[model samples]
Target: MSSDTSKFGEYGGQYVPEALMPAIEELDDAYRRYVLENEDGFVDEFRERLRDFGGRPTPLQRADRLSERYDTDLFLKREDLLHGGAHKLNNALGQVLLAKYMGKERIVAETGAGQHGTATAMAAAHLDVPCEIYMGERDINRQRPNVFRMRLNGAAVNPVTTGRGTLKEAISETMRDWATTVETTHYVIGSVVGPHPFPTMVREFQSVISEEARRQFDDQVGGLPDSVVACAGGGSNTMGAFSRFVSDESVDLYAVEAGGSSLAVDEEEGVAPNSASLSTGTEGVLHGARTKLLQDRDGQIVESHSVSSGLDYAGVGPELAYLVDEGRVTPVTVDDDAALEGFHRLSQTEGIIPALETAHAVAWLEQATSEQLGDSVVVCVSGRGDKDLESVIEETASREIPNAPDMDVFSGGMR
Candidate 1:
């Protein structure tokens, strides 16, 4: 698609520096040919690799305990079961493969929770390509396990210390790296938030979640679900879960965002206590796209906070902003405490440990009204909680998380 057609209404556009135009243009062409048109059996190969390597068709199982609690038929789209233990692999593998086909010899990317970094590293290793990942220093410390996983998979993990040491800075640093090394490197953006082909391309790659869930729901549940909910940070999995259901007017799509501590913004301090951009953000340009952002009155980007490092972002994906504007998707929020409760609740009841990011969606289910959910709902379990164990323990201990397990035994720390 052309730059104009790339947009979801006016929420998307190429707003990058002039130096990155050639790389963006080239990637757009490759996206059209390989991804859109499936040139050289690319789509076929991608699917084959996904099945044999990355593990396609993750289960869409009914959450019996959660359903009983919510008084609705609740199903979980178990993306956590996929290789790399999250939905990140779907896009990472696809982008890395695309880069290989485009004859790029190196891969670069940004990560917040480290799921994407780990996934990218695994894909690059499998494809025999050199890879590097830029991560915020704070996130690197919080997500040390994932950092180790990436290095184990043979990718360099570069820490970005600028700004709040979070997703925004990592993305900015990656863009700078890509701008300088555009000819030899492909920047595998982890989410559907960047310029032109990236938002569209990442969504298409990750849409397998809903594609399979939709089919499986029909087969198992006998009809369409009443609502489809997923956590929205930069909106890869959000768009993925909602894309296939967008045309289905009967299906309600809910994008649950992080409501860190409060929705209030300290404009003078340039900090927002939440990442609920979809719910409260105004329009602005950020990270090469025009979308909803947590910007001050003077248009300065504000810092965003979230207990889950993955969900802390100043802006959301352009398409998600457009969809919310069009009223096709409803934007919602769940506070950090509720999310922590959800993290423990699911683990106790459903025998599944969800990532703190996924916990946001789970928490919303508890807060949502019966009328909002209808009779059947599907929540995307975006990732497993293995990466968030340390953060969860610390946060759970700091607050009185109702569903949290006994912590007195490990009061010192998990050795």
Candidate 2:
């Protein structure tokens, strides 16, 4: 751990309201003891559960077709193959288990893309704990499959209708609930954002991505890749893919952000056409942490757009913001069109359907120069696309994506 513990350079700290202080303090202590010190074999049990339940040691497979197409050695960290079809299970299971250890009776979480909510629902069910999820109403409509999955796992799904009906509003609602019910409920933050202990604790759990990748890369390919790429929203997967590789000066990390329709913002309307916070955001305090955010000149958070619901966040993880500022992680953007193309490209060529969020990272391959990518590269495929089929069909039909297949065949429905 760093000397400061609660912060990543100048970015992370507990900036919550007074009502949430006790919960934060308790969580901070629990994180230090169970997570950091591994009290009562907590770490051992967590690993065993991950192996037996959540499916750890996800594959690091070489992408032969992608490599041949790009004339480079390309690899994929297959987090999409995890039990819940996303890297979200890594942190979700860990946090839920921690809550059990802390004697919490219920779990509450906020989700945008719904992967995190599904993972939390699964974990809560597996652990025999009650769970409730707060999600933006718009996202619920966009990701109905995931909503059904959460309900099937015996979790209640609450719709947050405030503030554009998206992640920011959902988080605010969850936090409000937590503030009132902190004694019996634990909040499972979906990503590497939020106040103290959450950013650090979530990273420690999610770091298993890079931990396995770094070892697998050395054993299979004999050295670090020249570059590692992963999509960044709230940046759990981005930090997961880059955490273990950060100390290696020779390895370059790229954080692909959703560029939406454009990078320009309508300050008067308080809307940013892109979710490229790490690329175009200025420093601001949001969601209890200091980080780069898509904000208007008056310091109000602006609405962000993304074809992928998962990447529609207005701010990024503080650690990722610090890393970008330190020049350890490069921030890049992929427009919705390129991301759609990459989604189809991977499905057609590699026989893999990536989540639209992961497609942002895939799109970067096409946008980056060969020299920029280097000869050896690794891309983290964060989630599967099953939950995105409806959105993809709709969005692809509206855009002139040259690689998109005919969607008319699905007129009878995806069944």
Candidate 3:
């Protein structure tokens, strides 16, 4: 609402091309007038969509089995149940509505893992706006199901082959496109990782997650949880799940990073090996935000690798960076193997299949002993796993821990 909300502890600000200044300033003004001021029923219409369309007040379910296994009480905030299959829809729908208020007819977004892309496309379709999504060529190949979903919603998905063909390059490309189409287009950033207004804007929309979870948790548990955990990749869901609890001194907050592999400090330069940006990064600027980043000695951003594409970003949200620096948030990591195990365990035990991105939080929660975390913990089950069947299949086949019985040759499985 006010410009004071921008620049989280000296982390977020307008750092972009001169051409983008007007657009950023305009959107900032609109955010204040429409969202902060609630001008002309804008907030009313947005809240209605969240309730009727995006499925607000998502459930907070108790994970009894997981709790018992880890000797602690575990609860899940099910944002996965939201429309478009993940927490991305919260921001996507909000931005689409704001774009309408701004008189922008077209939308462009950058996505990794395609959850944000699908959410953007879905919101655009519902609002009858033209939409285009930028994705890396590699992401298009691995995340084909989501790419198809975007096309089905009438969104044009552009593939970038530059610079490892991942989210970083896709962001670079999307920013360039937005610079040219600033008059008629609004750039819908997928997460809470962009410049000043964006990190603040997206977080506000997603804050609904924590707001709902807080009330629900209080109703169910009669007290604040011992800790709240969420995976951090660009940090929208984490910010959503943790923002409300920052002042609750008794509640510990955890942001689990993509533990791709060994926690070696510099296993891979430019990339946070195992995708642990906070654990293996120096402070630098990337993608128009000043925050914790992974770069080489020469200060070039490197490519990050993780089984979950969403976590493979070189930089993290400025708010999260500030939180980490201030010691208000603790950063941990879970590798790909642990994440997949959590995926399999939850699907088998709770009948819930979490997205690879979300599984990281689940994995960390399951691994933390009762003493490590308190008797009760809440995890942000950020998204569903329908988009990850292919990757999971490929990973499980190579894993040797739990043997699968051989199936009949003709039949796909044992009769």
Cα-lDDT of candidate 3: 0.88
Tens digits of lDDT, candidate 2, 269-322: 999999999999999899999999999999999999999999999999999999
Q: List the residue pairs that clash in candidate 1.
A: none
Q: What is the lDDT of residue 303 in candidate 3?
A: 75
Predicted candidate 1 versus true structure: per-residue lDDT over 379-403, tens digit per residue: 9999999999989998988998877
* List of clashing residue pairs for candidate 3: 260-274, 261-274, 270-302
Model 3, 1-415: lDDT tens digits are 4454767777777789999988988999998888878998888999899989888879999988888887777899999999988999999999999999999999999999999999999999999999999999999988999999999999999999998899999999999999999999999999998777999888888999999999999999888989999999899999999989999988889999997876554635445566777777778778788888877777788778788998988888999989998998999999988888888878878889999999899888766766657978889999999999888877766775252222345466566
TM-score for each predicted model, relative to the true structure: 0.98, 0.98, 0.95
Candidates 2 and 3, the one with greater lDDT:
2
Model 1 alpha-carbon miss at residue 310, Å = 0.8
Candidate 3's displacement at residue 86, Å, is: 0.4
